[model samples]
Target chain A: MKKEHVKIANREALIGVGLVIFNFVWWFAFAYGLGSKDPQEYTYVFGLPAWFFYSCVVGFIIMAVLVTIVVKKFFVAIPFDEEVEE
Target chain B: MNWESLIPLILFIIIIFCVGIWSGGYLKKSTSFAQDYFLGGRSLGGFVLAMTMTATYGSASSFIGGPGTAYNQGLGWVLLAMSQVATGYFVLMILGKKFAVVTRRYNALTMVDFLKQRYQSKWVVILSAVSIIIFLFSAMAAQWIGGARLIESLIGIEYTTALFIFAVSVLIYVTVGGFRAVALTDAIQGSVMFVGTLILLIAVIIAGGGIPNIIADLTAENPNLITPFGADGSLTPTYVSSFWILVGVGVVALPQIAIRAMSYKSSQSMHRAIIIGTIVVGVIMLNMHLIGVFARPILPGIEVGDRVMPLIALEVMPNWLAGIVLAAPMAAIMSTVDSLLLLVSSTIVKDVYLNYVKPTASDQRVKRLSITITAILGVIVFIMALNPPDLIIWLNLFAFGGLEAAFIWPIVLGLYWSKGNKYGALGSMVAGVGLYILSDSFFPQPFGLHSVVMPIVVSFFVYIAASLATQKKTV
Candidate 1:
């Protein structure tokens, strides 16, 4: 039998699902929630509506740094013999 | 008088032709004619594999059409297109080591080769061959038209004559040296694309007087230009989200790309590729689209969107520099055209001719047929390109959508889903492709989702249902 799928009931799974939901909410908020106003007119930085933009910048940096670290540590552990043998 | 502008283009072409010559020499070294011509002896390395994948996928659409659309749509298209940053990542992540090992084991030269081994069915092979030939013709024609249009813009040549020149140059080099020629040259073209995007984006931004100035100018022109909903609020949220499937994860299914997943030397290479490819793709996509929107303030009253990038580059950069910078899109167009030429040729030679016509054809005959077919396909695409589409990107994307719908479930499920058999595979492809065409025609953008969404769903069900009902031995 194929390996059983690990239950996606962890924090990472929740966060991933949450972020996707947030993406939809944010989009809907802009499309319908903001009453069709120009989004650039209000790039909130904190409690401000544009604060999300700053979050994206931060989120990108964080994701990049995290992925880099994970790759450096985790992916390197892949056995070299396993690579060529397969 | 303007030799500076022409100098870079001339130099670029010379370097590319020399690389083609070098690859041709390497092609001569291979003992078997078919092995050398089509698959490069199945021995591409880390850097070449990554570069080939990037250049083949980047295409004129990424540099030219993508940015043009971004220019028209504003920030939302940027968000949607950036999802494509994960393209190489997904292909490497999903199909990585296993795909390479299996194909090498099976001696599978083309995507159709994989299906042939898996199903051992001629119908699967024929269906795949038909889909690839038909859709790839549309895709190749789009690239040919883009190449001609770029040349036309630069030298003030008529589109038809420019197209004829472009076709001959690409066909000569690609036919002479097959995949190796294509891969080696892709490394060169990919670098050109990377640097070209940076320079042109910078020039367009500076010409627009910087980001804040551009934003202010956009607001003055129409506040909606700064919004995600497009100039007329037509880019619905659902429309934007569905693109995640079209250009993002769904790209894992594109044959041109999936073939590369199996072409690399090592998993280390795949790991390396994921990082380098993601960064390069991210930079190209973000900068190119931003340049498109950024061009708005500098070049007002631009009626034709596709011409926006070249016109803005010429306007902002000096003649010589603009010539060098403009080569980015030119590289994109040429790289895409060459890869498509080789792919369609292989589909004919390896997939159709060898499998059905002569399972034991001589290696010499195979080489000749492959070369002749590559040239013929190039000529046919040139004819299709003569009357260019209003926006070549749509044609390219339509081809993308259709191919993804046709192959994604079959490839993915075939690999992972043990229950997936030949019957299920055939059912899923037929259902997916049929609905994909039907939806695109009769009910485009159904329920605000992309035309591809429903077909993927329907095919997923078809695969499961057909497999369960058949209950043939699987995996």
Candidate 2:
């Protein structure tokens, strides 16, 4: 039971880390990859035309809130069951 | 003082005082003095919870210093500052039900109480107390300086005298009513923050003519100002990416923010706070920073960054409205200082004095010590503020970095990992502090990464390895 709980938590933690990494990379790709403007030219993504460190915060905030909901609702306790071992 | 300009500020003070008196009544009548004073008797509703969280988190940095940096750095700093929009959501989400449930179970008034009960070690209690007292004092001193400077600029008073008056005002309200006053005033101030940012942004746009005109002016002034790398290209990719660790993820460790996570009454309140707080923080941060850049075209040359907001407001709006609008930052600084002062005082009064000095101290004595220490802390911080820096943004950031470096691993790892025992917490803290200071003094950014990166990495290994090794020994 404890192992299951740890598994779920570890999964969530990894997903959390992954999302931010993805967003940062998306920003770099959008700014410099296909959308690579010259150093002198202004960088813009769509109408915004920016490297998305700040706007990506909106995505992060939503993810954080959703994680809290998931932790509160779906992430149920399995309780400690230590007697039966692998 | 100009009566016209001072009227809104006067009204703000009067309203805050009334709330303090009312909350003081509630506090006096409560069964648990510490609970009432420290955590609002754990009865805060969703709206109050959301507002208080927003106000507490939005410090002088958010309102004044952040925008000031934005003014100089142009829109890039805005991009960077918005990374903090997730702060409120992160706090509520990360330290939600577990922290609240565990804190209540432990009857913890402060973060140290939670740590003490969790670790059952006197060392954890002592170190947490010392860190809170030392680092929070520096943070509090920065807010005090910001407040004094704001008042000085607004009312045309000498900075020292203004500091004295502002010091007395905050100390008196907080000392008398404690967390209740802070929370209630936070609601008022938080609304002011949202409205003030809105009004100021609109006024700035009009002052600059419009976004297109503002862009043209900015391009004419310096084209690089609009880019991601900042004017001098100091904001490198590595440095910008590393800041995510500082202001974004690692903010979870700040005691001031961490304690907020433990304050609300219910999970529903926490959930509501997450939603409401994100929207508000996003609006405030985006608009304030945009105003910083927008103000550049409007008010061409301002030497000091801190004065940007005050000068912009006065330049565009009426002096009277400027004072009232400017009260938002004042509110932000005061709310932050009040919370930090109380947190530090509790670190001394509850964590140290009650735990070690006299475990059997009566309620009256605890209350007395809390108030006295808070006042003393306020006075000390005021003295520290007399010689203010030109831009307080750096001072505030240093304090932020110091606190995050000092507390992040111990608090976060302590919560999740069961193997995280006392030795691990100690070693992690030592590693974090040691590396942080070393990097701070010698090379703030090693290989273009921020100073905090190396320390955090070192601390993580110290925490995990030390905990694993210590666990075997204990077994």
Candidate 3:
């Protein structure tokens, strides 16, 4: 009974939330999982600590690209001027 | 005093003033004065929509306080701050087309207007207006103090003088031009922030003799500095992850931000904004915090955290270039201030005044009242900022938490849940705000999570329970 645009928005919102959870899981895993190790035992990637490089640096790039793809693929553009059915 | 450094900032202010004056012309030509002045007549394009959201959200904290914390906490704070990467995406997508179509159908100009029409309750509108006024006053005061302090230090002038100058610049543009002025200036300011952070990061890395040497220096100083647990091991994974609520998902509730969802021209603009806003927020946030962590070796033993950004910029870059680069923070502060000012003004003029004070007030009267209220609000905030509290960052954060707790459930559940009614909104807001204050004060950071988390969680249940309990009566 809901409008098509609202249904699309609801689906897109679920994807958005999924992406957020994915981002947090990705961040938390690399950050706390790899990062909890001792500093002397740490590795480096591109001059950043291995944990930070993976968690923040790589996390940022992956999220950006993933978001772009998700929006382009899954998200549909609905008209703003359409009337809402009460 | 370095005259070279002052030129770019002064020029920046001059250009902002010109934009304000230019946009004011549209205010005159518009058919609906309130819509044009408050929401820009829904004419925003994709790029401007993205930039305005970025610039408005990137306040003094992101530009100044964030880096300073990064300096103190090390790489962990950078990880913590990255929780904000999905802010614009969450706001635009979750609200998305439904919010825009519904608001247009209701003829809602402000977030409170949407709430008012949706709930059909006088109390909901009043509570929303009051919460916005109270919380945003503190937020605006924080911005005012930050702007003054930035100008005071950069130009080597007295704090009072800097405050006066800063107050005048913001008041004139916002009072004259309204939301269009805020959005256009935000576009300019957002660009400045992007380019400025990029330049400063590269310069800081170079000054530190490359990233490898900087990491080495940090390791030699304290191995903990390179870890994800912060310098003192206080940034627990639990606490850091909880920020996903405070800065990440809960941001959709902020009136200054939520209103952006209603202002874009089309779904194409919204689509474009989600992509652009996500990337820009990522780039600026990562670069700024990284610069903070990287600056520690170059300028060792800085006492205050807020001073880290300006001091590092001056140290790593030439004065003239530093001046230009430093405009990013200034841009951040002003953009936030103008948006908050206009928002608070509209809350009073559109929501409170028109609804209660005089429903039949003429358009001319309403327009005049909005401009006057904006200017008056600026002056009041300026005065409050004159004797600044020592913990301005905490003040800003408190405002964020308070606003989020008060409105998050009501706005979000109200939009999606058909069973959500006025009683449910009232219960959720009262419980959320009351519990947030009690927890923030008496039991600070229960279970190693930020204070905002519990209230938001509990409020969700309160909203559902209250709504279901009252469903039959309303029906």
Candidate 4:
């Protein structure tokens, strides 16, 4: 039982770390890749340029959705009163 | 001064006071004053937890200073600022249910309490408490200044008078009702921020003659303004990307934020908060920053960037409605200030004083000390705010970077890595804080990245190395 809990803890920790890395990469890629375009090569979308629209507006919505999905699906809901494995 | 606009603001203040008094009733009936005062007795529901966290995290910096910077930096700043969308998710998701369970097991009231119990070291607790006092005091002062500035611009009052009013209002609610009051008020304030930002953004867009006209006006003024490089093209790719660490992932180390991770009632609340908080933060940050950029076309040549939100609201909307909308920034500032005030006081009263100064002090004495410390801290921050900076965002960001560097590895690794001992915690903190301060002062934007990036990276290696070196000594 103890070993099983440890395995579960490790899995959760890995998921947490993985989520952090994925969120970081998502923002970095959107900011650097899409947000670094020159003004001369811009296309406007709903008054915002394509880069700003894609990287910030779309990126923000996508992130909110993605983060919500990850949290609800993978995160195990342990009762706070129970013994927490370190 | 527009007395009409002031009416809405006055009404908002009255509502906040009422909420404080209501929460004070709960405080009075609690069996444990310390826990109830500091942690709301760890009974925060899903929505309340989400709102309080979002409200506390979104401060005058996000509402006032952030939008102001966005106005100056153009759409690129908005893109950069959006990195904060995942702040709530990251904090709750990373810490999760284990933090809640462990903190309850330890009966830890403050983040320093956690550090003391986890590391079993006197120095670690002292350092954590000291860092919270030092960095959070600066952050609190920035919030005070931001609150005062918003009031000053809204009503055309003298800066000193506005500062005094702002300080007194926050001190009364925070000192009287404590964390329950802060959390309760934050729920209201967070809602105000959400609705207020959306209303103001739509008003700005409409006033500027739609989005197309606003973009054309910006492009006409400066073609670069419509691009991703900022108004003057100063927002480089590297600088923008590095902010993901400073404001994004690195936020897990912040005590004010991390403490919330453990305050919820259950894993269900945490999960609920992750979804609600992320959506609220995303909406508020995106709309608030966009309003900053959109304000440019309607109100050109505004000198102080911090005044953009209030100034734009007044220009585009009716006086009373503008006042109502401006409450968003006020709410953001007050929620942040109240939490910081309580956190610092708890550090003094519960962590430092109770632990070292007077371990056997009576509960009444601790309560009085907590209230008195919060009031004194408020006054000190008020005095500090009298001599304000041109932009309070940098001061706020400085505090964020310092706290993140000091506590990130210590708290995160200490929880997960069994081998992480007191020595590793101390070393990580010292290296994180020391290198962060040194780089911020002399080597800002090192290699075109924000100064915070280097310290966080260096501290990670130090933590691993120091832990490995000290493992045998511990056993």
Candidate 1 lDDT score at position B327: 82
On DockQ, the leading prediction is 3
- Order the candidate numbers by TM-score, best to worst: 3, 4, 2, 1
Estimate, for each residue in B2-24, the C-alpha lDDT of model 4 and write its tens digit: 99989989899989998998888
Sort order, lDDT high to low: 3, 4, 2, 1
Model 1 chain B: which ten-residue window has the lowest total lDDT?
A: B388-397
Model 4 is docked with a DockQ of: 0.57
Worst 10 residues of 4 chain B by lDDT: B388-397
Candidate 2 clashes between residue pairs 3 or more apart in a chain or in different chains: A44-A49, A45-A49
TM-score of each: 0.89, 0.89, 0.97, 0.95
Per-residue error at B418 for model 3, in Å?
0.5
lDDT of 3 by residue, B1-475 (tens): 8788899889999999999999999899978999999999988998999999999998724532689889988999999889889795888988888888888888899999999998999999999899898788778888888889888888899999999999999999998898999999999999999999999999999999999999999989988899998999988888988988988898899999999889999988988999999999989999889888999999999987767888999998999999999999889889999999999999999999999999999888988888888888888888778886655445565788888898998888898899999999998999988899899989988999988999999989999999999999899
Measured by TM-score, the strongest candidate is 3
True contacts kept of each: 0.03, 0.02, 0.79, 0.69
Each prediction's Cα lDDT score? Answer: 0.73, 0.74, 0.89, 0.84
Docking class of 4: medium
> How many Å off is the CA of A61 in candidate 1?
4.8
Candidate 4: residue pairs that collide: none
Over the full model, what C-alpha lDDT does candidate 4 score relative to the true structure? 0.84
lDDT of 2 by residue, A1-86 (tens): 25565565455445445544654555445433422344345544432345443244345455456645554665433322124447
iRMSD for each candidate structure, in the order shown: 6.7, 5.8, 1.4, 2.5
